[model samples]
Target: MIDLNNIEEVIKEEKKILRNKSKNYKENFFEIKNFIEKEILHIETLKKNGINIIPEINFKDLSPSLIEFKKEVKNRGCVVIRDVFDDNLIHQMNKDLESYIDENNYYEDQKKKSDIDKYFSDLKSGKPQIFGLYWSKTQVNIRQSNELNHVKKWLNKLWVNKHNNQTIFDPNNELVYADRVRRREPGDTTLGLSPHCDAGSVERWIDKGYQSVYENIFADNFIEYNPFNASYRNETQEIESAAVSHVFRTFQGWVALTEQGPGDGTLQLIPIAKSMAFILTRALMDDVDDNDLCGSKPARALSVNSTYHSLLLRGLVSIPKMNPGDTVWWHPDVVHAVEDQHLGKGYSNVVYVGSTPYCDKNLAYAKKQSKKFLEGKSPPDFAAEDYEVNYKNRAEISDLTPLGKKQLTL
Candidate 1:
């Protein structure tokens, strides 16, 4: 009764996939709404009763500590923990990466044809150009999409567990990635990214779904900072949230699988999230002292929300002098920068991930990105030259069995 070879049959079958994608869309948006709403309400309860909310996370038992750590992260608006990876795995990955770079004779300068200024100078003009080595078997296999799902699943798991065993984002939901990796050698200042918000703080102005993440702050009542409400990820709010069916992620993260120390380009984060967001939002409001912005400065001496916070941001933005197997996470609101690797020989290798809202604007970004990955071009906003090797010679990678080579080539 059915025409097996009919194009119409194939189209009909694909419609089911579209429906599934629609469900994925609602799930992702609602997850963010629920999380933010519940959190804001809980924080409010604490403030009403005159309670303190900073909780420290230690490694002995991750579940309890992570819950508390998350609260602190929310109050300050960010968090970081050292040693979140397996040390042995990191050692091996780094060993392979170093060999890949050395054998190809591709240093950061090589991508520019040994012309650092010729390539890096383009960055200052706000043009996307990378002149460093991009192709590494290790990078493709371990750093690219091959590891994307695995890392995201792990992080989603962390989110679920941290939130009292509630499923946060479905692993099968349609998600998008804007990520990159690098091999920064000693004195590698070529990868410098200036202080700026990802996607120009699009979440605050346009994406109402994402705005829910900060709903409490929008509330007139500052004392209603709820710590454990689930509404932040589920509640509906009026917004021109982009409907491009793509994800401006909710989290931006990296796996520091190498033992890079202070001068070795580890990582640094400004520890205040809410205050930073308030200040950044109101940056153009006035030239007044930002110290008078947020509810009250934490016990730690810091301003609530102001350009003065920028000075404190400079101080809080410090690398923790890490060892192998450390994974660091920070909020998109907080300003972050990597210290150039100035030591004799060190690294700061990582797999970047973020909290992208599943929406229309991001979907357009993904469609563009999908084409890039196929042609071996870098994704939008990703630094150039990081994967130069892969870009120049897609054929070589086409033959080699890098992780998920079949899936990506298709």
Candidate 2:
């Protein structure tokens, strides 16, 4: 077992192990560099042609064009699926959520509490952008909606789940990974989030399971590294942290609850799908310190900045405008961030939802989360805010649809 107390020692030892496996680390570094350079050029060309780098597909066309959709998603690492839910339903949900917050005096409760979670403390905003509130009737209904579940299942299918004749995950059965919500007001002046990858930080370089997932890159064959291969992703363990997600999400996503577009605090992404190989290889080069993995640390999101990741930053592009009921999804390894300010005249709202498939690892998390849901407590992966315990109109067992019960493992 690796010692978390002696992280530097662990880092040094892990680097040596990876270098041995790679044999010719220098050659591997160059290969990844060349690949990233080509991808950057391609992204520039797309930009010059007035193309939006993030792929957008309407939900109505999903079934007939799945093959092509998969290709686009795999190539870009992110997509926006339009009209995934009925506009009227989404608008109502938004209204319901607003009532739930006001009736419970959520803003007043928040003001009295000090920051219990530091994940986004670095971000500057007039008020909290993310709310710890979960288990609202609106959130529960959205999670159980058949349309959302169907879309999540399709997103999960983008990953290769079978290897050596053994299935790694079930894409057909989507699971609920209860997360928080975001409500950014008009004229919001937030510094926004910097570029980063979630799920794990230094664990990606030190954990045995993560090493296996990136074995192709470590073995000096980065060109063959397939980010969608679910070979050992479920087996990877992150250091204990409130910011880290315990379940394996094939794609991190959010459903828009309002109309918002570029310059309105929307999301931005480095659209190249295979750029993760460049990130991994860059750390192995002679420039990075042996005891460091490009500023990664335990219990924090993996940060990507100009200091160490200037090349990948060149491809950063904001998502196109999104309407209520639209949703966006991105690969786990994709580097993404939010725009610094909301220049629009309305609130930008979204409910977090991820493409968490049915698997042993996720099932275990769901079982734990179900108990919390019943008690109106926060989910296992988040801070224990318990903000909804006695809140009015919080979803209860009677409120769940049959599909909701199954997804929540209730």
Candidate 3:
């Protein structure tokens, strides 16, 4: 971890680089400070209103004509696309997952295994709520489903490369990133994920590739900083760090397999993305140099707490109630967390199905993931342990659709 005391010098050094790059950088810095203050109020107001500002749209109704809907997603950096799959399909997937868990004795196996520490730290004082199995049949089917492929295509199109109007990827061609299935039972709060963004953390400032994504912020026109841009994100590679995500997922998503409401251990997010500008410019206001990038050397989750960002901490709101078959997706830069407690009646089941558009780095990850799929091993980005390798019902390459095979580089 970088010393919190050195944060002033660190910001000064980064500011020097920004000053040399843009002529009016200092002027923009002052402007960004004022903008941050206004944003603090705006975000607080939205937070007070709850998740009302977080847009909810039907997947089938998605189009350019929904100008307000598009604007909401662009501004907030997250959305709930209802009915991505049918209720029956959602119920079936849940059943399939339960079957797999029962057959493999997942709870028993997990309790016996000592190396299941990739995702969580301390399991809360009860039964495990999340399963790490990535290649389950239902997961594979959803990843390779034609309906989901279309949905991903639509999701990718939501982003536009505003820089030089240059297209950097094929939004229509889907790419797959296998992730875990979360099954949060009522009153279960084992996952200790705090308010944080998962993508690059401090790399947003250190890594030149990652820093390019925030060039507008450094230039002092942060209000125009479009998160949808495909500038440096296409090339940003992961450095040696803890909690690294290799794939540049445009949006992190989940397909709900069970009905869940706000208090049901569901997803929580701070809807505004422009507020991120404050994260960098905060040193100008605070006494502590806005220290603790919260995403320093040994990269960890980019955390948001009352000490550093009280507005954001208070602004974090739970997404609206959702039913099975609903899909919720958040921008890569959004600060999100799982509710610490589940005060609902039943389990909150969902599969992580993020979007990975076609890009050189992402394509490379897909190719590697394909190889891991063939070997019945965990993907390179995850822990190397392969508990599913000997499982009889694991999904294989043959089960993938034609497009799915293509996405996996098979």
Root-mean-square deviation (CA) per prediction: 13.6, 1.7, 3.8
The lDDT of each candidate is: 0.43, 0.86, 0.74
lDDT of each residue in 110-135, candidate 3, tens digit only: 77664544433321233334676888
Residue-by-residue lDDT tens digits, candidate 1, 1-410: 12224523433343233223333433433343444445555655654675543233333334434555555666554444444455786688678766665655555445454332221221222322222332344444444443444444433433322245654334333344545555556666555543433332322322345445544443332345342233334322322222111243445666565666556754555454543333323321233332222222111112222333333333334445456655555554555555543463855666554644334444555566556565555554443433443433333436435443432322
**Against the hidden reference, what TM-scores do the models get?**
0.56, 0.96, 0.88
Instruction: Name the lDDT of candidate 3.
Output: 0.74
| Sort order, lDDT high to low | 2, 3, 1
Give me the candidate number with maximum TM-score. Answer: 2
Q: Which ten residues in a row have the lowest lDDT in candidate 2?
A: 120-129
Best by lDDT: 2
Off by over 4 Å in 2: 121-128
Error (Å) of candidate 1 at residue 170 is: 3.1
In candidate 3, how many Å is residue 403 off? 1.8
